[model samples]
Target: MTPATIPSRFGLACVLGSALLLSACAEKQVILPGERESVRPEADLSESRIRLDGNTARAIQLPAQRVNAEWTQGIGSPAFRVDHAALGGQLQHLWEVPIGNPDSRRARITASPVVGGGLVYTLDSGAQVSAVTPEGAVAWSTNLTPASERAIDSTGGGLAYANGTVYISSGFGLLSALDARTGELRWRQKLEANGSGMPLVRDGVVYVVAGDHTGWAVDAGNGRVLWQIMGAPSVTTVLGSGAPATSSDLVVFGFGSGDLVAAFRQGGMRHWAEAVAGNRLGRAVSRISDVTGAPVIAGDRIFAGSHSGRLAAFDLHGGEELWLARQGALGPVWPAGDSVFAVTDLNQLARFDASNGSPIWAADLPGFVNDKPRKRGETWAHYGPILAGGRIITASNDGLLRFFSPESGQLVGQVEVPGGATTEPVVANRTLYVVSSDGKLHAYR
Candidate 1:
C-alpha cells in the first residue's frame, strides 16, 4: 500500500472518529462431558417468528443459508431464513473460570476468549495469558510484564491459534510463538513496550499492533520480525485492540491516532497509508486507546470504523478511498452476513450498508438517557458486537447484553449481565460466554 501524504479530513473524521476511536472502546469456557453441564442450548427448539422485545426471547426462521444482501438504505425484509426465536431465554450455564484477581479489575479478562480445537485462550488483568479446556482446566498460564504501568487497560488483545501454534503479545513488548497443545514457548521477539494488540495470522505471518503506534508482521514459525511500520492503533483500551484485515496480499490496519493503512503481509512493506485524523486530544487518551476499530476485510473493500465516529471503505488492493460516513461517536463495526453493525459511543447501534458506506437501520439502546453513560465516560457498544446463530449480541456501558435480529436491526431480547459486560460475548458450541466487570463469568445458551 502506497502511503498518502495528503490526509483527507472527512475521511479522517469518519474513519478515525467513528470507525476507530469512538466505536473501539471497548469471554469463557466450555462444559465438561458430565459434572453438571453449566448451560445447555434452548430446549423449546422449533420454528418461530422473532419477537423484538425485552420480555420475549424469540427467534426468526429464515432459510438454512443466508446470502449477502445488496446495499440498501433500510433493513429490508429478510431474503433469507432466520431462527431468531431459537435464541430463547432457556439459557443453560456452562463452565466458569476466574482468570484475574477479584480486587484488581485492571487485570481483568477483557479479551474475549478464542475457542478453537477444544481450547480457549484468554488474557487476564494481571497480564497473565492462559489456555484452558472447556471444563475450566488450565492447560497453561504465563505472566507477562507490561512495558508500562497502565498497560493493563480495560482489555487485552488476545492470542491467535493456528497451525499447532499459539501466538500472543504481551504489554511489555514481547511476542511469543508457543506450542498450541502445550503452551510451551517456541520463540519470542521484542517490540515497543506496553504493546498488547491481538495478532492476526494469515498463511504463516502474524500481524499485531504495538503501543508505540506501529504495526508489525512477524514470522509465525520462528518469531522473526518480518516488518514493522507506523500504522493505526485501532482502539483506546489499555491492552489495545483491533485485528488487521487482510485482502489477497494486503493487510489493513488503523493507527492509534493518525490514519488507516494497508501493508503487504509477506514483506514488511507498505501498500497504502491514508491519514484519517489529527491528534487533537494529545497522546494521553490516544495512547490509552487510539484507533480501536478493526479493519473488517470484506470482499474487494476494507471496512473500518474509528473512535472519532467516522467510517470509511477503502479499496483493498490499491488502498484508495472509496466512501466515508460520519456517525458522531466512537465504536467498532460488527459485520453480520452482508450488513455491518456500527455502535456509537452512547450505546446506539446503527446498521450500515456493507458494500458501500451508507446508513441502513439504527436504534438507540436505553441506558444512556440518565446521562450516567456519559458521566461515567463509558462508550456504548464499547466492546465489539457478536454476530452468531442469526442474532447480534451486544452490550452497553451500563451493563446490559441484548440480542437483535441481524436482518432488521430490531432489539430482540436482553438480559442483565449484573456487573456490566465490558468484554465481547463469545459464542461457541451453541453457548454464550460472557465476562462481566464485576468479576463474574456467565454462560447462556
Candidate 2:
C-alpha cells in the first residue's frame, strides 16, 4: 500500500497478461440499452450568445390587441412604441405597386412606409415620395431630389404624414412639406448637413436628426427651423438613420456616435446626454457605435439601443439609467406590456423584461445566405418585431415574413415576401404594409 510500491493500474494490467493488455490500456465507450452509435450534433455556428433568463421567462405578458387607425410616423408614432396592434386575420397579400427606385449599393430605401390621410406613403432610394391609395393605385408621386444633388447621392432620409401634409427629409440636406392630397410642395428648407432619419411630427413641430449629428426641431407647417442642437460627432457609423422619439415635454434624439440626448420640446435646451456605447469583444461591427434604432419613450421611461451592444432604459425626467442589457438592437425596440422585443445583432428575435432588462427568450432567425454557415456566403438581415394580432411579426431580407408566438418563441406561421422587405412593415387600419427592396409597396389584409 506504500505510495511508491503501488504500481499504476496500466502497469499492473500490462504485466498481468498480453491477452488482457489491449482491453485494459485502451479507452472505453459506454453504450446504454437501445442506443446506437452516431456522430455528435453539429454546433450551431449562427447561434446568439444571449440566452433566456429562466426566472422571467414565464412572466412575460402582452397587452390585448387593439386596432390602430393610422401609422403616421416611420417608428409607428412620435413616442416610438406601439402596443399590440390588431391585424384581423392571417395576412393575405392584397396588392403591390411600384413605389420608386429599388435598393442599390449607393442608394437604399431606408424609410418605412407611413400610412395616413387614407393613403400609404413611401420614400424610395432616389429621394422620391409616392402616395398610394388603399386600392393599390398611385395617388401622387413627388421627386424630392434637389437639382444640385445627384439622384444616387440622395439616398437617406424618411417620410412622415400629419394633418394635411407629408413631411420629408432628404439625404441632400432638405426638409420639405408637401400637400398630402396633391403632392404639391408647400415649402422646403435647407439644412447644413444631410437629413438622416424620419421626421417626427407632433403638435405642429417636426423633430429629426441629421448626418452631421445635429438634431432639428422645425415648424411642421412651413418647414421652418425652430431649434437645433449638435451631438457628438462620429467618424464611422451605420448606413441608415435613427428617428427621434418625443414625449410631452422632451424630445429624444439618437446620434450616429451612440449619443442619446434629450431636449426640451419647446426650446431645444439640452436636458441630459448619455452614450449607448459598449462593444462586444471580437465583433468588428460592434465598434461602429451607431444608434441605428430610434429611442422609444414608453410611459415615464425611455428605452434605446445601439449597434455597440447596449440596450438601456432611462428615466424620462432626469436621464438616469434604469436598466441596461448588452444586446445590440438591429432595429427599433418594441415595448409591449411587461416585455420589450427587439431584433438583436445576431439576427435573433429576443424578448426582455421591461422592468429589469432580464432576457425572457430568444428565437433564432435566418442569419446566413440560405441559412448556411457564414463562410458559405453573405448574411441576411431581419427587421421588425412588431406586435400585431397577438403575434410577433418580423420581415427578413431572405424574403420571408415570420410570425411567432408572444408567449413562446415558436414560429407559428410564415409568408413568403416577394423581392424581400427592405424596411420594417407598418400596420394601420387592420392592414399590414411593407416596402420591398425592389421599390414596391405591398399591402396585406
Query: What's model 2's TM-score?
Result: 0.86
Estimate the Cα RMSD of every predicted model relative to the unseen true structure.
Answer: 21.2, 10.3
Global lDDT for candidate 1?
0.59
Clashes of 1: 68
Name the lDDT value of residue 253 in candidate 1: 67
- What's each prediction's clash count? 68, 0
- The regions of model 2 sitting more than 4 angstroms off are 1-60, 76-82, 370-377
Identify the candidate with maximal TM-score: 2
lDDT (tens digit, per residue) of candidate 1 on 1-445: 3357446655776676676564556423566685654374453321121111222222333334332211110011121112121343445555566665332544545455566556666666545667766666778876555445454452454566677777777655778777767767788888765556767777788878777777888887898888888854444433456566666667776666646777777775787787444221321333333455566665576666555546677777887878776542244466555566766533467766676766666666653234553474433444646565566768654677777776667777776776667566665555566666654456666
- What TM-score do all the candidates reach, one by one? 0.71, 0.86
Put down candidate 2 lDDT per residue, 158-266, tens digits, no spaces: 8888898999888888889999999999999887887757788899999888888889999987777899999999976665676788888888988899989999998
| CA lDDT, every model vs. true structure | 0.59, 0.83
lDDT of 2: 0.83
